[model samples]
Target chain A: MSEFDLIRRSQEVICAPGARYRAQCVLGIGDDGAVLELPPERQVVVCTDTLVEGVHFPLDTGPAAVGHKALAVNLSDLAAMGAEPAWFFLALTLPAAAPAWLEPFAQGMARLASAASIWLAGGDVAAGPLNVCITALGLVDKGRALTRSGARPGDLVAISGRPGAAAHALALLQAGRVPDARELAALEFPQPRLELGLALRGLATACIDLSDGLLADLGHILEASGAGAELELGRLPCAESLAGLPEPERWRLQLAGGDDYELCFTLPAARAGELDALQRRCGLELTVIGRITAQAGLTLRAPDGSPYRAERAGFDHFGGYRGEGSPAAS
Target chain B: MSEFDLIRRSQEVICAPGARYRAQCVLGIGDDGAVLELPPERQVVVCTDTLVEGVHFPLDTGPAAVGHKALAVNLSDLAAMGAEPAWFFLALTLPAAAPAWLEPFAQGMARLASAASIWLAGGDVAAGPLNVCITALGLVDKGRALTRSGARPGDLVAISGRPGAAAHALALLQAGRVPDARELAALEFPQPRLELGLALRGLATACIDLSDGLLADLGHILEASGAGAELELGRLPCAESLAGLPEPERWRLQLAGGDDYELCFTLPAARAGELDALQRRCGLELTVIGRITAQAGLTLRAPDGSPYRAERAGFDHFGGYRGEGSPAAS
Candidate 1:
């Protein structure tokens, strides 16, 4: 298919019926731009992320999973900001116009877009190395968008769902070991915590999604808020598959391995009960893994009450750590 | 620099003051997402465009010009939509962490952003072949945005600024001939008609930007409006440099050349005087070039009333045209 044809087909796939974003979109696709009506009293939140082949995903990864993860990562960012997914603009570059790849990619992207109720507003497609860059826009009430700079000392630090399964799956895949179904699912189609994010909008003091593992992402919250964190290593919710690994290896995946896409947030200590109630209501695991600290650095406490030192914080694109033992690192 | 440090430096480079978007931004860089307050009665207009090395620009093109054109193309889309440029999100991919490239690229982007009053809201950077994808957002009053599908029979077609100068420049550069200063400026720094677009919001019946040459882009407006157009080839305003070329070459550049970030629109014949007034008021050149017709295909008339046939409509990324005689095609 031509670039234009692919765009038209992708639009059809992404803007399926029951799209909640339709009401807000005055115009979608085909125009020089898309027009969206901002609902009264709502603020716009915008974020962008790019996924590169061989960097963000394996070259052999399925197009559908690639598309899903591309949008999911941006959604996770919006979720971190306590914003509701509304609209997205995609810039897709590919080595060639392979219909086989484009069709499944569009389907995967559409499935998640439909689930999130975010419509594809506009996009550009070009011939180049495979890359997908998505800029997602969401809406939140005025002054209610959670920011990383709002964490405070003594606040309870929490995480929605478990972290590190994606990393474990990546590790296994790189080591030529096929992961179990659950691990494969985590690696391929990890869900963004949209509902949990919306639920925490007015309740959470600060928030971030674990794109770069728990420790690294939490470090962002701490640095932004001018605080520290004390993570209870024992309380970390690890994947069931990770339970078989040695303690140090398991902890490495939990603390430093990336692409978890789980929300790591802070809330006042008094709201711990409310959080529990929210967890039960939403039927999603919400675990208190740590607490914001007055100190200016991260500290990990073991079950034996001793400080734990990690080999590294997280994956850094330009750092010395190459993806030697990891699947794909971005 | 690490990704985080690069991000911080980029934020500093892109958020230089006098940014008109700052007022609407509830939060800018350093957050998971940028928060924006929608003006009370405005709708958001968004457009995305990606520029790939060698496809969008000459491989030796300066980083600054590449960055400027990346955002400029998206701004041109907003201008086509009669939207006021407000903010933009960037996804920059680089082969390496070269400060020499990043510094100038950011400066070029920020310079235009400051001039247009659009702020850099948020972005992502990754390692890959150099590519710059920009998603720009603008604001338009309710139902006032211009669209391509609003033309009518007898509407006078017009163009803002001369078309094809950029394409001519590219052709000359590809032939190893140095373009004049004017031609170079047209190629590297085509200014988007932001003011003209905002002014034409309520006046123009239909609009599109000449990114894919006049014929192809005008065809879009015609097809969208279920109409056609008859161009007076003699009426096309050719650049002085192009005027020296043979008639066929000159016409080819004017009719089939791409990369002219100029607005082409149709307006009611009775509104011609109003457009003239707008041209004078905005100090812009608005030339009447054609008229919309009920017929369903575009036709070109020579000054002697003979039919004018172009070799092709415009540049197509996946088409047979491979920028053979043009330095920058996209």
Candidate 2:
């Protein structure tokens, strides 16, 4: 598809209407900037993500995956705050203006956008080394935003959707240990759990999207909430693809793999029924992975009742900070 | 300064109450993302821009200049549409974690943010080749967005603020031809004409920020509006800093240089009185550079009333695609 064609296709997907913002956005997408109407309430949720060529993905990654991931990640952020996605802006740079690359990438982007009912809105495209920055706008009722600092002691820590699959897939890829088509697909195109996030609104006390390894990401919640938690390692909702791997490898992958795109949240224990009801309504699985504690740091317990300490490391955005078993640079 | 101190210092400058979106923002800097009260009005404006190392700026440039330029550039897009900037998000990638580099950068950014009366809502920092992507949000009246596609054949071509100083500065920097301090200041910091854009609400037939050089950027307005015009080249405004340069050299810098951050627009001649009135109130100069014609493309005329044909290449994102007179890389 040509750049225009890609835009046309994606526009079709992003044009869906559902939840509306109080400040009714008059014109979105297809312009220099997305236009919004400000009501008296005057509150909006805005988030942005930048995906670099090699740092965010492999150099030879396909355009479609690149496009989908770019928007999906931003939407995940909106979900974390119980906000409704409204509009988005894209700033795209490419080493060269390759129509072939632009077309499929936009097609993939449009497919995800249409499914999520997001509008392509307005953005800029220019020539440079490949980098894509997507800034998304979402809406929430005034004074109703969920924040990372709201978790209380005794809150139940629950997760929405499966975790550790993206990490495992990345490990498999890096290890040159080929998985079947299904596993490979998971690694290449991990989905963001937007629905799960929106459904967790009143059910979660503190919530965050797991873009980093579970241990590292949960650490953020703990740090922000000023509380600690104990997690049952075996309770993790690891992907079924790991069933083929050795138990130890699966455990490590579940603990240390990043890019899960799942929701890790905390809420009062009394909301167990509500959580169950919401999960049933949404047709998604919920895992009671841990519980908030008065203590001030995380602890993982193994199946045999010993403290699980497998020496897992968190994802490192800076080079030279390596996680355990990370493939050495050639 | 520590990362936290840098953030604090910058926040003091950028997210002040007078900044554009302060009233509606619930959470500004020092959070994962800026949260705002999404007013009942459902319309908004969003845009993004990325400044890369060695490409958009020199590696040795001051952090404050980098930060200010980054946010200012994005704000220019909002100004083009007569929108009030409300919130901003940043995504920054650095080659290393150097607090020394970050402090002044944050200070510069915050200062601009404060002066613009907009909030620094949220951002992400990681390690990589230096890159900064700033996504800005703005509020506009529903259906009141000024777009590039509204110019008519009889429209009068008008502009707010001087142009070409930025390009001239780049040339000077590259050739080690540093002008006096005043000229250097223009090159280092170019202001965005936000108030002028709002004042032009009822006057401009079409508008855009002169980012990619006047000729090329105005071409976008022409293409979008399906109209053409003849530019009186002699009528173009040049910075006083260019007065000392040779006339031809001055003309070259004025016509072909980019990064002026001024508004280039078309207004109907009927609004001459209103334009004059606005100039009186704002104390900003307004110039009639040309007139829109039924013709299909742009025309240039010399001061002697003859056709002016000279190199008018603008900046392109692609490396070496339109290198013009700058020293070519080996």
Candidate 3:
């Protein structure tokens, strides 16, 4: 589980299968930088995410979960843009030179990366307050990337999976309502739906990942698309914890809770059937809780047809809350 | 000057012309995660670097310099593999929101990225102990990456520019010795020799960037390439700081100091004429510092032919002269 061992394991798992990028890659995982093959016509995509100690995770979080989540969040962003996962670079910071921590962290990272089919490129390691940064790259069809600015006024707003589950999980963890194992599993790890994002390439008019809560994340789409939105709060998909909360509190959490990692997209009403078919094929629920509007701001409505106010904001790293920021906020 | 404004400015300056990654990049800056055009045949290169406050830089370091250096260090890794600069992502954590500090920092980053012809594609913003993580992407020729494993006994040891200036600068800074702007320039902003690396593609036997000082970095070459090196101390290039300080201390800093963004490379002696010509054509100075030896350890020789001892270690982020638990040491 030493740093070197983790690096070796990661190379074996993530770098072995991706032959698609072999032409431009001279040296990959074991080097200071992964070399790429830049052909005349091909372009590359780049993105980065940083997970910090007591910021992105609880102070007692495990290394393996940290590693997996680091890679997953980066991939989630790629998924939002309808990009296929291809390669990644990691910048890891550690509190100490703990081999045991590094081993499991690398193992978890490699497992998730391999599952997503991303090639392990290269990165730098530093000693610091526990921090993990991942930069990811993926390839897509030329000029066909789904962007947030492409949605039209009448586009039907959709989400790839249950929206408030991660937020609920966060709440449960903070409340100590779940035991160590369940709380750790929920808080430390959330799945990134890479496949659904790739499948959304042509179908999604605009796409975004739900990191901030449903309302806040949807706000990004609306702002980017230069349009407003109207969402039905009652239609929001919630997990059991969220479902059990009092209606006002539950609705509030669903509206502004964060860390969802789901894909929210917009498409024309004409594509409703197509989206429904995609949901059936993927066996994941598709929620149509909102629509792009010509108005200038976001509006929320309750299940009882009452207007819901934007009184809450999503999770903020700088905004103070006890126990690793507020689960209610997330 | 707010974080949002700083990001907007970076988007304007960093996203310049003649981008090679136009095809794979679906969305650039101003998004949660950038989308890429993952073509079937091309492989991508990804790398990351992190700079922590009070570890990588003084707390009061200029925002622009910190931003530039963070990205530059990562770019140096890409250069070692002869990768073509393509895209970049950044993750930043700050103690508190600072509008003035953010503006200059983004400006500095944008300046360096623009010079390197790289696009600042995407990044994340958060609050924490103040750290900057940068991930960079580059494209290389198919299967043509230069690695640390390609050197042999007969290879010629070479370097781009003089070394130890950065270490000298660090020493000076620590001692509160302020150099004129010219001398301070090298210390504040070190250049990664991207052009030299690309040009050495066919000439170098192996290559690496000199971040961890010469002797220690050379160790990586020896270990990875499985060959010993014989360095001629007389032939070693020394900068002004080396001549300015007491001889032993000066040489120690020069030989064992870190942060010189020069290129240390090996090439067959048969390519001597080509190497010389390449240097001349590029207006760069190429010096022969040593030769790869058949034996498996590094040996330094003075003008009188006596063996000189090399410092067994260089500046280590985790294990160096720095005190307990530096966040930069991962």
- Name the top lDDT candidate: 1
In angstroms and one decimal each, the interface RMSD of every candidate reads 1.0, 3.7, 3.6
True contacts kept of each: 0.81, 0.50, 0.62
Model 2 per-residue lDDT tens digits across residues A1-330: 323334455455444444344235555554556676644553467778778877777676788889888888888888777777767777776766566777677777767666666666667665557888888777666767667777888888888766767777666667778666766566567676767767777668888777766776676678778888888877877678877777678876776676766778898988877877778887878888889888787777887779866555466664333344312110
lDDT of each: 0.87, 0.72, 0.73
- Tell me, by DockQ, which candidate is best: 1
lDDT of 1: 0.87
Per residue, candidate 3 scores C-alpha lDDT tens digits across B1-330 of 344444666566656565666555666676766755545454455667789887777666788889789988888887887877788777888877676777688778878887888877788777778889987777665666678888899899998888877777676778887766655667668787888888888888899888877877777788788788888878878786567666557657767777887889999998877877888886878898899877787777876899876544476665654222211122
iRMS, candidate 2, in Å: value is: 3.7
Q: Is candidate 1 or candidate 3 better by lDDT?
A: 1
Among all candidates shown, the one with the greatest TM-score: 1
Tens digit of per-residue lDDT, candidate 1, span A153-181: 99999998888899999998889899898
Which prediction has more favorable TM-score, 1 or 2? 1
Q: List the lowest-lDDT window of 10 residues for candidate 3 chain B.
A: B321-330
TM-score of 2: 0.88
Model 1, range B1-330, lDDT digits (tens) per residue? 777778888889877588777888889877889999988888899999999998888889898899789989999999999998888888989888778888998898889988888888888888888889999999999999999999999999999888879999999889999999999889888899888888888789999999988888888888789898889999999788887888888988888887989999999999898976898987988999999989778888999999876777776666634222221111
> How many clashes in each candidate?
0, 38, 24
TM-score of every model versus the real structure: 0.96, 0.88, 0.89
DockQ of each: 0.76, 0.41, 0.46
